[model samples]
Target: MNTRLLFFLLIICPLSAVCQTFTSSNLPILVIDTRGGTILDDPKIVADLRIIDNGPGKRNNLTDKASFTSVMGIEYRGATSQQFFPKKPYGIELRDSTGINSVAKSVLGMPAESDWVLNATYNDKTLIRETLTYDFYRKMSKYYASRFRYCELVLNGEYRGIYIVMERLKRDKNRVPITSIKKTDITGDAVTGGYILKIDKTVGSTSRSWKSPYPSGPRNINLDIQIDRPKPEDLAEEQFQYIKKYVSDFEASLAGSDFRDPTKGFRAFVDEQSFIDYLILTEVCKNVDGYRLSAYFYKERDSKGGKITMGPIWDYNLTYGNADYCEGNSYMGWAFNFSRVCPKDDFVLPFWWDRLLLDLDFARKVKEKYKALRQTVLTPERLGAFVDSTSSALTESRQRNFVKWPVIGTYVWPNGFVGRTYEAETDYLKTWIGQRLTWMDINIESFGVLTALREEAAFTLGPNPSIGDVTLKLPLPTPTDVSLSLTDMQGRALQTRHWPAQPKGLFERTLPATDFNTGPGVYILTISTQTGPTSRVIVRE
Candidate 1:
């Protein structure tokens, strides 16, 4: 359970999400979590953890970013300020109950905890001091280091500059794929089993100790950043469906034992939105287990006709929270967000521009989706009660008074249940919703390219294995020399035809496939010309 909790906590942490640091260096708890089920006395871990191990004698364990992965992949390294971190560590345990303690002390230049929240310079300092409050945790063993952040995502929804990337573990190096067979048939079920076995994948050592805020030296954590390239927008659509399933499973898991629905965690607090709010949230924010995992389709070239569909699910880590990380993506933090993919002031794609241009569409349609889903997934009663309880729990989690979070003072919960959320804090944030709505006015446009030539090269293919000829709908830009090569999935060229590229318009071609021994399988059609290249897939019986 500790291992699973640790893994999930690491996946959800947002502060150091930018580093994608899955290093075993700073998180010494992972070191002590020898048994798979040990619960953490978290306060102890935060106070003692250090990024550098620096053997007892040399005490300088550092790693740098210059040695950052040559290729963009998931690997963790230790560095500070974009440089590898090589420093000695503080040893032995002290009885200091104050959160201001650490082994990376010298690294942080021993500044008072007051001077260091996000920025602290410690060159002559002896060690780096770390801090934590009880509100950060969900259970005594787990914390929201993955979700909550001191950084405000939206200063009134005007894009407060934040970007969050969730780091979920994918297949292990020795993982095997189960491509046994395919079932084209379909019988609709409320819950169609996912083709991908996500939750079942085992968790093991593929990450380091402190996989947060990189600069993890001597920590063999792979920091993978190059997300799968974008496929056709349709591909993105398919991924949306896949994640819709994942969310269902996660919600069901909440019903599992040992889980707390957001509302009943610690104390009673009102959720600003109704059951409708939760529903709309789950609908638009289709968070799949693999939303953070980089899968094969991210780069697979097997597009039969549609583009690959997945996601950059960039604003994650704040799972089940209201703070944005780097890219002010307040899209779902209990408030309306204009656009995270594209700021209104910047030139963006037409589709997202559709969201920016018509904020009302997102607000209304999303509101409707929320309303419908709320009826089914989260009942109004369930949410109404939860709002009061969780809000109370949030108010109670405040303890061990830190100046930064003065809201923190002597607080206790009933039988381990803590109230969360400062009522005033929630209200302060809500008032900005209007300003955020106004901030979506960023200019959305791009520079047009005037190349040496111009024409619309759109085409369509159909009626494979026809007794007659195949008609290909083509929109050519100019009448130039064009060659068409037909092939199979194995790249075996089947036929070639030569023709002239027609003017920027649609044309048709009828070809006979009577010579090829094509059965019920996949085939490819490639049209090449001086303008560019286009390919399509064909299925024959």
Candidate 2:
């Protein structure tokens, strides 16, 4: 056993007997026995793991029968967390009876997987930062996010406080849902996909990584992309070169002058919707480490929307007004502008976000998506309920957890706000979210030339697939100044007409098709009022 582990057990074990014995829990109970072995950063030690889950609304006790039991190879996880925090997180791999062969079994209600993470959210006092962020991302995007369950852990007779057993991000049908690649898949379409790459600090990662061809955001910092799936040993040289070149080409295209060109530019290389959704989530939370660190991107087979897509966001413990640095606590400002905010930070946000916003269509889509989400998943009422329910569920478990590690009312590094109680922490989180949402609503509009009006009923445009001239109708409630403009799909202005003081109720104008020299394509017809701008798709036949 290492000196640190030995010392910890020696000091803590003797004192634990005097403390309250953990008897029962409202949450699931995970008990692990290391069998006198020490848990290190690597070269996992053999451990016996058992889980006791009494289902919802039932109490789980240490004396109860275990629902699942297995031999597991366990090791300490996290880079800075392992170094700084005494309450350690763990990475576990299930093993068979021989303790050598791998095994897969469903733990709690999650899918059967051998690889798992026991995240000790020690820095996060509320203990719901990752859970809340993942849940919100899953609700917002169609992509798969990690599923987790909160539980109490007892390691070698020592009650180790609250930990979340979460699905580790990897290639699985129930997880990333991408094509599986092999060493033999070195040619044709097989060589093209499914690669999972992560941009992160390489402190403890053993995965093979490559530096980006482009500098990150006006800085000389080179972003490193690590291959997260298909272990480096299993990958062929051709496969490695192919993915590397593919990412290189994407960067080149995005940086090119024709980047805005839909067919030939960056648009063809990426899934725009995924990027937009990622932007919204990161900005909404004002994640300090977002975009630059722990960022993930994946590509599937060419047949399956082959573009590089941003997704499956990870490590957001420093998000939602959590961190004190880089304006993270502020409810205002964009997270994508991290380079401008911090400038000298080692990790820098890529230039993709700034470049993407240059496209009017992409900006419009982002605005529309944000507006839609605000009406549904992101409302204050819905979010507040989530926080409340989560807090209520952890009511019993939290007391034991706090007792194990009394961090409340004390300052942990990078904490934006230190609340005296759990209630205060939750209340601060809720208030920050509400303020952040409002700030984003007002700021996101500056992305493009037009700010979308709240009321779609303000104007109407018809004969959409117009054979000739199309009529635009505006039923103004009050006399208003309006400017009507027609533009090609590329945003080149075709014509503009202005009325200084248009009379109220039913004003009409005919937009002649002959005036649009551009033929047989989609066009944008925008109406600019004192309130805001509203745009509609007008097809020229």
Candidate 3:
């Protein structure tokens, strides 16, 4: 066959690329030869310090005056029959209320059993839903490392450990300097701590390939964070103290509390989209002999499924000092549904409004507890000694360490993370974590431009479903000359009025839209400002 004809045949066939490159899936390789390298880049294992020293790796976590530690025991078996690298003990150090290695190893470490992989693949466009599985954790980890690498080495003339970072994807990269993240090697779900999914060299031609639980997890344009899968007992403790929802018989626009009960809220803690997604996904499932494997979901076979509850209550890691990373690195508190794109489907807005302040209250309490735990782990004298002890371990064991925050900024609020410089170095974990938890402050929206302008556009002119007696409230974020007008779908003006002193702050007034030359189906109330006209909908029933 000619070159053109051969190319055409290849186009009609699948696996042509893989077939040309590899004898089988077991031994496939990429051009960069990044394979065979350890993700952690340990100096002892790699030999050359520079290989482990691209820059530095860093960790940050949220903290506050009241924070406390919720340490669990880290158990070490030393060696295990199961194939995994982090074989010794980590939970010991984390759960140890005492900072000392001797106490932590005995108290925190517990015997861990089997490790398993949950493999998944998507051709494309899990779209918005995939953002959770793919983007959030990767960016958060990278940004945390970036900020950490550039942190001051000698905080007030004291030694901080060598830290390295590796956040590799652009989608996870934050643009704003205030966001304190930097570029780093980011991996996905499949990489379980320091384990590999397959071995290419030793397997050779006969070598078969299999997935690694952690490594294979984020193999595509993927994202992963080390999340200890929830145990059955752990799931039982995950319920919220209270969950309330509003079931409005009235239209979404009709704002009133007549139907709202004082004590209990609506029956479900679910939003409309979540409920819809839930209902759709449930019906589409195929029933099998004993199990209904909801596994093959993305088969465009059907776009249906039930609602998946958002999470397992993240953002409290610093409340326990389990990880040395900060929240701003990932901004996990927000951005779950950016790919979802619909105003109605994006639930974070309401979720944030509902939970931010509540999280802060809980965070403050947790913050206090973590601090006291830290003190128990370290004395004023031992604080220095503790730092000295861990410095060598970091350099020997890990790569991508850093000592700075990423580069993004939010509105400068009081008691926030951003300033021209760092005020307290040792307190990095505490202050940094505090600013992160504050992002959920529902009042955060109140301090923003979107809220100000939207509030100015609010009013309730109704007597039951009947409409009239419309009132104007103007408190736009920016000042501009303004005018009010009502318009029908065909661009015909029903009523127009000019306001002379629109003012910088608040303004409210009653309007006469009933007299306009029009019949009522639906009309728009338009507030024309020097910047632009802000519009809201009105019904003529």
Candidate 4:
């Protein structure tokens, strides 16, 4: 065959394959040009980039004065991802003519940002896991979930399949809203807060990390956490010590006997709502690395919440029935229990969640939030529609993507295969999600309620931070002897009442302020049943 015919057969002829399902690409085309055709593993290397809209009919066309930028990195997980495949991810940094970092003009109507990621969908056949996961978090009102736009990529004049141009997670007014740390402001309130830390495996420049004090799994191993902001060199000694000490104190309180204390326990150092929301998202998807890796938490200024928040979820390509290992593809079990199943894994989840699950209050809150979310965000109809719309958007571009890198009918690393073709892959995702949501819906409602301790126990306390009188209520699951104990912050019982063989009904009692010490502080209220002990925090004002 002639060389020209070979070139046409391989590149120019879009429909060379007789079984072509789509003839036209309906997503924007991104063209990247490297000076020496060298995009390295390092994020700093720069290559030029251009945008050409290829969607149906036409959209905003690039102008003559359209600003462009530099690109770097071919693999997303740095060098680790390169070992698996030839095609890799890339990073784009918008720059002005003077080579200074600047925001690029919005492309395909995406928000303007200085940095963006062109993720390679090599591992994920559906090519929508990350985007869909982010969509779920954003809909659930997660703080600063990265927004993304889908587009086709051509690097060094070669087609490189479908890619998503997503906002990079960082501290900025438009991103993670938090106080910016400066080396100059080393003392006092300036250095006390605002830090982003990640629980992940050690890699690259992020080697400057600390190990957890508590051993997590059966191996008695501690996980490593990396500081994302305030580069180690730029961080002051006091700032470093302050953050370390704060986390250490929080961990100490959480592991202590009085871990349920509202004033000095883990609740005081972490945001409750944020934790619940994170748990729902992670558990719903059964992310293999949910708490073990790619887990992020941030702390703000003392005046602003003054607590750590788990947020801005990252890396979900291996989630949502995607992974075959560690029971990731299963629709059963809780994501928080991954450590119990895979304890010997190098990176394990902290025991924080395990301990939290033991707390009845936290479990109840999770159930409540999950119940509310199911009606709106996690509903089967709504989730199915979202997946349908995403598949429709990729209908035309998917053919081109498959043509560029044909892995549809093949296995990639850790996939729990359900089908082969693009349509089959997408159908698999939709069906898996629908089934997963159903499993979660049924399980979450009965989550902590069906514990061996009780079948239908109802507990509530009102007028938190009570002034003179406090009310405690308990609706027992079965007829049994129960004991109510009121204690000070130090776990010393102040008042105790015993009820012999109480029936399965609501029990209400009022504690007079005169019986307790006269002052403002925190106290513990415990109701011990034949099954187990239920605890709550009572504040006396």
Candidate 5:
């Protein structure tokens, strides 16, 4: 052994201690010798790691030459799972010779990355929930989802059962694919682009975070928002303020009266398609923590689709009928409505989802997108095939894992249902997915209907990105008096017009540019009728 290896062993374990060795099977085997040091929640410890994989159709033995070897730093990962589960997930950092500096290396055909995660899948007896969820997101969404590989882990002298080596979520060309923020890029367009934020619990490590200015949906709770990228320490004051304000502005517009406006509403700041996809994924799986926690959204630079986009989905072990609480196991309801289902839960979903559904256009798009996805990636047959393939791959490894942990027939905390066998667990998952898809297909049309009644009375603004004058095409059901008023973002009225005894047909009126001193900004035009008041957003360029 080298001097450093010898020193590590001496400091971490007894001199006479003999580490256990194992022969692997069909799957890639990862052997980690931590000397004898315990992996903690924070501050990783140095370790020696080796991987034995002889490629496809080949079996690896402990005595075989290692395909890859590295000096590494390993630590316990996950929140509740780390605290309660004996089979714990781990965070890994590939280290250089000194065992201090991180070095990126590709493992098991995955892209090179210094940071990676070994998910223990303690709660998921089938051991495919996280992998399946990530795969589904990757197939359906344009955004990058974490890539994962299944492997059996041996820590010190003990076998750690089946664990997935997955790419950690971060700013990388193959990961989040957002412009990296730098200290110098703290002004103008440079500062505006590329930010990653998450709404999650603030119980762990200290990181720079802010609270939502608006309360969570009917829960009256302000969500704790954390800056995921640009590392909290590296984030400049200007960068922090810029992202913070941008989110706040999005919330403000989403909550405004004319929030449905395509140009001035929440649509102006967010990618509607991403939000739609996210909603579909969450609802399809009934993820207990969806939206409220582990939810990620990123904004690229203005030149590159500047709108804030949701995804690169993370932390999905508690999804797809996996959890017992908050109607998580049910395939009948929308996951975004968790606040209403579990009002007393400490974490509440952000108001953005409910408000977004309130917009007719957004709801229509969501329905259409879900309908389209069902024909492709979200189909029952395709999903079932993926589950079966993954189950087959892990058939041998799972027996070994269950022998080590013995959680197969028993209930893990928060598990909605416990199966007597691994096959049963997977069957339940498939059944749940089928039911969920059917429920969504039958009920998703309601989203389009929920806001249509209110929108029917609203007028449509034409030449929306109007250069000068704009036309309003109003469909009146009956002759009545109508009052029109335009207001700025701050709710300050800019212009007012009245039409008395308007015909029941479509009424078209052109508002002259000179009527209001317009430059470049967002204006809300409200039309008050006897039935109710309706509003539309107008953009002045």
Candidate 6:
């Protein structure tokens, strides 16, 4: 093929350019030859890094050995007895002796950033879920999502696999745009905001970690929510409390009786647009571990949005019908509803989504956003095109990657579904996403019915995101059946209390911390009336 035609083929249909030279496709090839040929499971290891790209040449193709660390989550571990599958995820930080990011030139079209993540999409046979998810989020108008490039990775002079060369989630101007908090600036707005947090299972503890003050769902599970921006040790107590209190207050609004109140409800704390976008994306993919695990939220300075914002989606390897566990393989359900199916899982999704969906205004926004996006990004034609182009781009690299690891036609943990070929995996994803979009289209049309019903019996809870006892207060609109029930975040009723009908007036009920079997997490407090049922979110100590 002519050079121009080959370039066009690589650009429009990368799969068609399989016979083309690696340099012709303009894809960066990263070569990591470990120093002294030693690779360890320990994250403290450093490795020599080099880049060979057909595009912009760097000042130095080689760099001072960068510190390398093994990156493993609860599912993917360090090593296993599985055959011919030694590839593991890794994190690379390029630093100078001065402990600053080396001011190096750009590599592989990405600007030089000290932190980079080399994702080992081993379990994801298609290898495009993470890439596709990230791209979709970036296309949205909300918070900044990570930028990535598809590249072939070579380790120890051997082709390990195809890996995504991407920017790590960090507090940078180009990444999570937020005000930086200095050690001395912990007193005011500088310290009070711009914090990145992950609501997920604990990886390891740094200096700073806190459990949710309330139970999360029906199981009353209190999850370990970690602070990602300020290393726990480096973060001061006052600064920590400031951000934590802000989140607590936000939860308080979400759990309050007047939650839908314009000035006092959860809407006051979170950017509604951002939340809507986040929910749509999460539901669209039906990501199994989405809201419960690998969930990221960031808060900016009081001068900025000044509230906790859901953003910059991370760790989507098990999404897009890729995982067999937790109904991830099914395209007809919502991922946020994970608690409804697996109520007792260690990492339960927070009740935030459930409560948010209860608001008709919020639900309508989500519905509107979904419909709008379908005309654009989420449309079948556009989404299918993305899947096709991406699959084509990775065709040759994927074959090489699978050959190296050889997990094809084999089952991987949490893989709700599996396919034997790369094409099969891509096809499954495309089909599932299409079906998911169709389901969401219909469900969102009637999204407000639940919200409207809940409003008819609206009530309030106090000291939400609470640690211990909670008091619920409601007004008896009329003399009708009055019964109160407590539920975990997933809406599974845990305890129910009934009250005899009384004249219209203020009514109060106290729920001690012990009343909720699960402690220090989020739970729902609902009041059922002859008209309908209304609920509020409460946190137990």
Q: Rate the local accuracy (lDDT) of all candidates.
A: 0.27, 0.81, 0.25, 0.70, 0.80, 0.68
lDDT of 1 by residue, 1-541 (tens): 2244334323212332232222222111112111122212221232222222333223221221111101111112112311321111111122233534321112122211111122111111100101111121211111122122211111111111111111221211111111211132123331122222211111322211111122111111222222121212212334434433333343233333322334342101111122223223322322121122222211111122111222211222222222233123232221121111112212111121111112222234343443444455334333334434433432311211111122212232100111243443333223322232222111001101111123223466768545445778765543433556666666455676655323445567776666345655677775544323356777776
Q: Write the per-residue lDDT of candidate 4 for residues 263-315, one digit (tens) a residue.
A: 87789888888888888889877898898887888888787777888876888
Candidate 5 lDDT tens digits, 150-185: 998877755677899999988889888889879789
Per-residue lDDT of 1-541 in model 2, one digit per residue for the tens?
Answer: 2334323432223233335456788999998989899999998999999898989999987778888899999999888888999899999999998888888778889999898999999988999888988888899999888999999998886789899999988788988889989889999999999899888888888878898877654334568888877788988889899998998899888889888798878988998889989988888888999888889999998988788989888888888888999778888666776665565577888767766766668887888899999999987778888889998999988877887888888888789999999999999999999998987776565455432333246577778787788888876654445666677766566676656545556778888778677899998776654334467888877
Candidate 6 local distance difference test against the native: 0.68
Error of 1 at 445 (Å): 28
Q: In terms of TM-score, how similar is model 1 to the real structure?
A: 0.24
> Residue 488 of candidate 2: its Cα lDDT?
77
Per-residue C-alpha lDDT of model 6 across residues 246-337, encoded as one tens digit per residue: 88888878877899998999978888888888888888888888887768888888888687889778888878887776567877656665
| Model 4: colliding residue pairs | 74-89
Evaluated at residue 25, the lDDT of candidate 5 is 65
Off by over 4 Å in 6: 1-26, 37-43, 56-85, 97-105, 205-207, 449-541
Ranking by lDDT: 2, 5, 4, 6, 1, 3
| Range of the 10 consecutive residues with the lowest summed lDDT in candidate 1 | 124-133
Worst 10-residue lDDT window for candidate 2 reads 5-14
Angstrom error at residue 444, model 2? 1.2
Candidate 4: Cα lDDT at 421 = 76
Question: Could you tally the backbone clashes for each prediction?
Answer: 90, 0, 101, 1, 1, 23
**Which candidate's lDDT is highest?**
2
Superior by lDDT: candidate 1 or candidate 3: 1
Runs of candidate 2 exceeding 4 Å displacement: 1-18, 450-541
Candidate closer to the true structure by TM-score (higher is better), 5 or 6: 5
lDDT of 1 at 102: 28
**How large an RMSD does model 5 have?**
12.5
Q: What is the lDDT, from 0 to 100, of the residue 189 in candidate 6?
A: 65
Among all windows of 10 consecutive residues in model 3, the one with the lowest summed lDDT is: 284-293
* TM-score, per-candidate, Cα-based: 0.24, 0.80, 0.24, 0.77, 0.80, 0.76
